[model samples]
Target: MGLLPLNYRRPSYVAGSPRTMSDDQISVGSGGSGGSGSANGSNPPKPTKLATVVAGIPDALGFDRIIDGGTCPPCTTRDFMNYLIYVERSAENLQFFMWYRDYVKRFNEAKTSDIALAPEWTQAMEDDAVTRIQREQADKIRKETKTPAIAIFNGTDFEKRREVPKAPGSDTNPFSSPPQTPNDRDGSSDYVSTGEQSYRAQANEAFAAAGVKAPFTIQPFRKEMDRVIATYITDGAPRQLNLSDREQKVVLHALAYTTHPSALREVNKLAESTLRRQAHPNFIRWSICNGNTARVIFARVLGGSLIVVSTAIALALTLSSLGRGYRAVAAIGWVLGIATLIAAWKGMCVVLHGMHHHHVRPWELFVSEEDADDLGKRSFDSFGSANSYEEEPWVVRYHKRNLIRKIFDREVWIQEPALRQIQDTIFLQSMLCALLIAGLLTAIFVASPKGNFF
Candidate 1:
């Protein structure tokens, strides 16, 4: 009987981006560059591009409009903050989405592979075959003693092989030399010391002594992040970036959700289109805008117009009041006018609500700065050395892990509440206008004497 089905078609995967099944672990390879081509037998793609990425997002929050090319709204500090968040979220979500889909695919392949060869071999086992499978290899040590006895290795010992020096080489000089200069072994307290030193520390120091960079201290390339974030503000709107599937969902949710609940949450791919159909909210305070910011904009515009009109009217009336007994009232009015003018000059601003806060530069998140100086010089094409960015680091995993740790533990600046309350004054103004209208209407005009000649 045939051991396994020959009709099995191994699933083809997107090149550069591979995923595992069962777990959401994803590993991006050289990229889907040729794989996308190969998958469709070298045919052209269905025209997916960055524009499609932007369009695919549901505009419930009107975030798409902000990113639209037009006269950008007046920029503010909050906009910068939101833009940074947007870029960060874009990178994060896109990466995860790539990871998740890739993982599921790999998982399917793995699951299929696990059963295919296992069942056939298990059922075909005879008593002798079973015994052979279970048997352990015997250690065959050929003890050849030379002038200085050194143990030699043959393949006889598969599990355990203890190598001993056969004899000192002719070139061996035991105490050759010591370094002329000794350097400080201690710096960068990466890990907390809690009494006894573990073997890990020795290993780390030994590794470092041999000129290896410290592992835990792998820090962030701040300049790259800043550059990437800055790009998102060009039109003062978030340009949708390339993100993985999981990342897309997370950011989409983050855009909608008020607070971060938890991370690494499972999201449904099937319902993604439906979920994204609603306009995604961009507001995370005053800076971020979503599709829903129309009301906010209109309100602000009307309020600003009102303030201008009010100032003009007060100025005109004050000129008249200067000629009469209303001079005391005019004095007070002038003081109020000056205060309002100063406030308008210094503190007044219209806050835009629906805005895209994410920015993504091609080389933004990929960089890991060894130092601040390295940030200004490195080529972002690939993960190159801080010293020379001519080529991507062969040690990608090691460098990347360090980069992630640095970013993960990074601190963020929390905005003061006072600034926020200042913006909220718009709401107060709206209420004041409503109350004034009501009070004036309520005061009964006893019928203007001259008008009602009753």
Candidate 2:
């Protein structure tokens, strides 16, 4: 919500009224001075601001018809102009959405001259050029004359020779005017009149009808105007974004678990390829243990009890006959025995569970086939669907030298249901391996008391 207090506002541009007048009749120009003074007082009624005009346009003209392109034919000059105004206004409100902000930034910078509304020559731009020429002429006159000019010396000759800057469109092309392009198959060409003159004419009519002087200057916003027209031609709507099919899926499905719109808003924070690269390694061995929770807990308790019992027996032997010489070995045995108990308690298997003999049954660990399958699908869709024929560049797909760096650096994670699978599979495997090694060492110590029983 905005900080400002809310008050009621109304549209100023009333249509089909006595105030509407032709450009020749409208006296207000760029000079910011006098308005068509009202009879009631010397002060004229204030014209509507640009921001207010933008907000009120939907009420004046139906904005929905332009956005839903199929419902209407190709956009006209007025349609494109209104759409540009909408985008300019929308971009101002981008603080609330990061994805939209990024999209708008790219959309603004992208090359779009092809679809830009071909600007007709405007008297305003020419007048601006003439003003510049007049300034230059004054400078030249000052430089050329060594002495002060006599009363007979008139500057009429300099005025005739002064050069005006050409329009951006005409400067590039040799033709005096932009070449007329063929109309689209739909019979409406994409190019429309949007020069300063066109807006001045429209604004004059609207402001006159409303019985107020113009509030805003009608100036050329060439680049922004171009983007608006280009977007309408390509996307069929000014606000519509240019996202791919894969990106759309990621945006929608990646944040499905979270209820917050802010969480979903992060969908465009990274590239799709980056997400896929991170998801691939977590599914190296996708096997869901069809293990019952109770059975796994029981097995863990039984395994832990056995290791502890054995460790106790070894400690007793070391204290009685093995002597202080075996103290280090006994300490190692105790550490190993305790780690094995932890492994059993957690339903994790350190030995390769996918191997035939070492495979953990569903009853051995707390995992379900359905959960594994769903995770596998998400993993595959994220990265595994790449074409086999095209290899990723070595620079992008290369592995790190350090094991710790490899795991931490290459991974990109999102908060999702698949994270649970990562914890169960990858995390469990690592812990189980640590427990198995510890348990094996403890057993060896129990078997070899003299330290020479190789």
Candidate 3:
């Protein structure tokens, strides 16, 4: 969870360096500590430490390195995005950032092509276009029928029109003997029924059959851009982002002229800043709490209970006229209780420290199956199969365990050397504190004028 110092800087040839890519390409200078702009032929803006880390640049300290030593998965980034979506409920920023990355890649690939074109629209423009298209289609249908059309907008006709058409042979009389063809003889055919086609496939087939190509003005990826706007940029959207009015206006205005990635530059910068400054740090803190805080609380409660029981036993032993030596037996509980309490105060789980493993967090274990599947599908759709995110296998197994077994589970090893060192340091400190406390308490118990030596 440690962050880079304020003065930390990436090397000149690193991915986040000013010379590596444009400010917009890697989102350099888009964080809170980043410079204002990378314009006016001025020197390129220096990338902030957080920005560099996010851009996949390795820092001087390997804090961002993969914990298990292999680097393919980048678990920290995956966990950060998952936390934003599931815990913080601020997924739009990450979604927008990810979408922007893909957009940039596509834009670069097509930059030199003749088909590289941009769509332009405002809310009013889009609405008007849809209305015009509908009116034209209705006029064409009327002219073809040569009948006065009755306008019924109740959607009944629309639903009927959308129903899939039955196959030609399906409506034959059932009592008649069916004619055998090549397909029947083989029990298979190359032909696929329209009813079996997905809605998207059916729509594409309809358009192709009609020889109706949409106008080039519609632009490639126009539908995707509109979806992104509706889902993340527009007010009253399902996951509308927390953007400033000025920033929102800038984006909408830019879209009025072009759907190029440049149209989203300002909004992209703001989203990146929000993720780095707020969501990323908050995710780290939440991760720590989810991973260790519960264990600490359990330790504190058990430790306090032991301390109380130990004190009561020593008092009972004195009152019963038992020897002072017998009262010393309470020192065992005192030692363990104090050590556990000290460890808890340091946010260390004594059992996990000793075992060199951590428990699967409750949130991680209890994630709904639907959510996991949806996340996996979204990741695959957005980033492709190679980078698709999958829930850890241990998470599924953890969910199947009973309550008692779940509480005692320690399946995740502390793979990071730094984390192991930290745990060791905490354990050593707790033991020293326990010994000091036990010696003091034992001395008081043996010297008290409560019972004779046995």
Candidate 4:
């Protein structure tokens, strides 16, 4: 109930729609903006914003017959341009949902150059080249550059002279524009993309020489991407990520030597090999939140609850269809609908998604053994635990650290601690709200309003 009002005044509502209002007390009209409990000018829904986001694409959300083949289909620059426009529009306009439906409709009907690559299969295709290059090009690079032999495998990240990044189709290799053969001339020492371990090590060395360690994620995300991509290709294909019977039977069902060694090492010590290898029951829809994969299971629970409540109200109205009060009952659905819409908008559904993935399920806290790739070594203890504050709270920790450091170093620091006080004020306001809601619900029956409109 408080969700609708609480999430109402948001500066930016990016995830979905806001929480719906109570069907019993509020009236959300048909006018645009869905009657968002706002008294200002009405604004329509922003569907395009929701659509552009790659997360939680509806199972029904896909092209009916997208082309796949020898020549890698180049995504239409125009369609991508439109998507960018929609993204920008959705970011600015409140009524962007009106435009969202049109964009999706355009996609299904129009030919888009932007091909949908299964996120899981990307690693395999990349590292295949890594291996290919290690065999064919590694020797050539060392002799030409006179530098240490730095092999660029079909690994995840590689520097491409091409403007658009991503693997070319098996037949349409993007490497052909100005083919990188073993015999190409020397003088180009910086051939590596920033994704490689050697590249980063070099970058870090340069930073150290300049007297600083750039605040960067020590995680070998590029290598991880490479490993995962390679596995997916071996497990299934570039077009679809559905693992084969063998892979599902073997890899998906059990734990093994994979991308995450440190985590596996710790978990293996705690659980038996059989249990450790058991498929993660809740891996169905987990995604990274600040580098930590947080499942949006809470939204599902809340969405389900709203649905049950709405169904009951709808049933009650049908039963009273012949009664004089039928009019009031008929409006009940609109009330419930608006309420659910509001809740969905407020990221309540996202919370439910989180809950579903974490509830009653034991999952691995380690990275998979995909580190078997030749390009690099996996960082130990990279994955953060489920309950660690090192996730989103890092921003706060940074502020706190800098604050204490200022006092310790005898430097004048006034910004962050003063900002912390403002945050505390907002926290107090939220506490007051919780109390107000409890008091209102408890006292509603005692203080009946004089017979008003009814």
Candidate 5:
């Protein structure tokens, strides 16, 4: 989520080994190369070029494009990260990278004194300060204004109290007819309370009344760094990274003195490079394969069968007593077969294209019922029920559908413009390829001798 540190440079290392240069050779001081040079009274050590984790993967298919595009769900969304954690069993690489990104952001934003605070703690403190300020402003406005402040309450509040009960036998309803309250002024009675707003307001008031602030200290950051090291960098950790002993030792040694972003630079580079060169390509390929529903796969197999059948039919027509023109009819089968194969290869379902919708991905459908319920609830809470992208209804509907229905079900719409464009391109390409293949087959059938089957 945060930009990588500009000062960070790639480290040189071999497979399953730490950097060739010793820790003494690299400087972690704030003054950069000059600090190292001043201390040693010698030229600063130059960075070494490290070999990539994997070599066969082409540069063009690297993760940079995905990160740049900023639209691919796998690279951008939590769902993909969930896939990596639950399905792929390689979550630490992503988890470490994500944590490091945030760490870099906090480190960059922090002052010298604030550097010792954990990033999460710093973020929470900032959020609390903002919330407190906003609440104070709202309270001040309410106190200054004689009339009820409509701006303080959102639409949901108005909806809940739209119809104020008229005072019995009263000529003028103070809170209703004359719009005495903000709720009566804006008519709607659909207020749904989750109690969270009231709790937050009460907590904010209590904090303000007491003039209390969360403790800010270096201990929290040090503890957080220790936990991070234990979980990721330390050997035999619960989610220990595939780092070499030397790499782990370097990070541990650096963190011994300070919790600065520079402390974990070596480990960060290793994790990032691993994800970029190895995990990312595998994720992309897996996502493509996983994107295809059972129906799509069936269609692909059927297409291959059609190709075989079409070839046999064309051969029969050519070898039989039928006229050369009759053999050209086989072009229709060739066209259908080629088109279907193309669609299959691209993982684009032709039926889903026309419907402008797609089935929930296989990983989504296969999640545990509890996870599905949680996902649905979160989706509903964040985006509401009317949103087409809401997950709850899709999960429920997916389970309710029979095998045949599931195969045909179109749940989520192709909402992303880029993805829609890709499908459109694939469809068009398939058509052209099919047409080309059909034309060639037809030409050969018509031009060949009556007995010729080639």
Candidate 6:
């Protein structure tokens, strides 16, 4: 679980410089009893004794290396953009660079944790992960609420705020706020917007509202996404970062599957490693369902196939016999078939909603961002022991749903394409079975002898 699990080593502590007294200087004493001490009875100034002091002591408790563009190879701003930014640009801004660096440092440290070896994440881990995520999200929200839509500049020297000009198809500025007197903390004379509104008309309106002079114009944040992307693509043989083999593996596994072209190019530039080559997102996702759980899923699929096939045949036969039916057999078969479908694809058993020892969805296996942050906190807080999931009253072990719940919650799993495919396949099979039964019934009814019964 730790970032550099395979290669991280604790650095040796070197004691700080010991304090020492200067030997050259001595304190002069006043003439003792006036007669035997000095040629002159006047007291001389005491010899100054300067203390030898050492400054700029290195941080001993700090990590041997800071995880940032300055030290980490894979964590460079450019690489960060290539791997994480382009794929989900809106999720990050300049501030995310700091978070990413911290994440790298913590991930590297997690290798030493006993929680890493636990079969399932503990409640402490989930709490740690969730708390951090909520904090980050709140911080982001607070920041967005503070910045204005437009920043005016008087020939590059920033000027006062203004109301945005009314325009068709323009978004309302969320950053707009009432003007306020200058304060000690912020030191601003006028009202300021918190959100960054990225339109030109809004800037013009703000300027007009403030009655600013014509010489001023508004500008947006200087985006360097394309420029960085171009450089990343062009730099064919850029020097690789100095990373241990284990760090390299972890970094590559995450980067190798990114949608960004720059990331893919970097993967190509680096010498091929087995881990990198095999690091498909689906394969990584599969790991979320541990080995034992995967077997349970396969078992569901096997059992479900038989039930679904038998149900289809029984329903078809009942329909062909003109309602002189094997209703009990059909009901049992349908229930088993439905249960199997749910267990195999949804990874939730209809019979056992809140139980463990059942197949789970990939998303279910992984903790949410908030939970992950909470778990991460445990990495530092715990003294070699962590709180188990069972100890937490709030932690739910399984996804609970009836057919209706599944329908409503379908969108929850929509983002997961692999799971989506599984659902789609099961849906298609269900439809085919229904169609087969209908076709058999229609044929029997059309064949004259059943027409009299109708």
Task: Name the top lDDT candidate.
Answer: 3
How many residue pairs in model 1 have overlapping backbones? 41
lDDT of 4 at 308: 56
Kindly indicate the candidate among 2 and 4 with the higher lDDT: 2
lDDT of 1 by residue, 161-268 (tens): 232213222124332221211111222111122321222233233223222222221111111211222222111213323334233323222212211111112222
Residues 171-214 of candidate 3 have per-residue lDDT tens digits of 24242222332222333222222332232233223222222322
Candidates in order, TM-scores: namely 0.21, 0.21, 0.53, 0.18, 0.53, 0.23
Residue range 1-454, candidate 4, lDDT tens digits = 0122222222221232112212222212211122111111212111211111112211121111110111111111221112222222211111111122332233233222221111122234334433553554556555646643333432223422221133222224232132221111222121223344433333233223222222222221223323222322222222122333222222221111122222112122212111111111001111111011112223334445554564555444444424333323323333333333443433222222223211111111122325222101211111111112224333454345443342222111122221222223323344454345434432442233323223
**How do the candidates rank by TM-score, highest first?**
5, 3, 6, 1, 2, 4
Report the Cα lDDT for candidate 2: 0.31
- TM for candidate 4 is 0.18
Tell how far residue 203 is off in model 4, in angstroms: 6.8
lDDT value, candidate 1, whole model: 0.26
C-alpha lDDT of all candidate models, in order: 0.26, 0.31, 0.51, 0.25, 0.50, 0.30
Of the pair 3 and 5, which is ahead by TM-score?
5
Which candidate number maximizes TM-score? Answer: 5
Of models 4 and 5, which has the larger TM-score? 5
Please list the Cα RMSD from the true structure of every candidate, rounded to 1 decimal place. 23.6, 28.3, 14.6, 24.0, 21.4, 29.0
Which residue ranges in model 4 land beyond 4 Å of their true spot? 1-321, 330-337, 350-454
Tens-place lDDT per residue, model 5, 84-141, is 5545566676667666655555445443443333222132333454466567657756
Off by over 4 Å in 2: 1-302, 315-347, 350-454
Better by TM-score, candidate 6 or 5: 5
Error of 4 at 432 (Å): 17
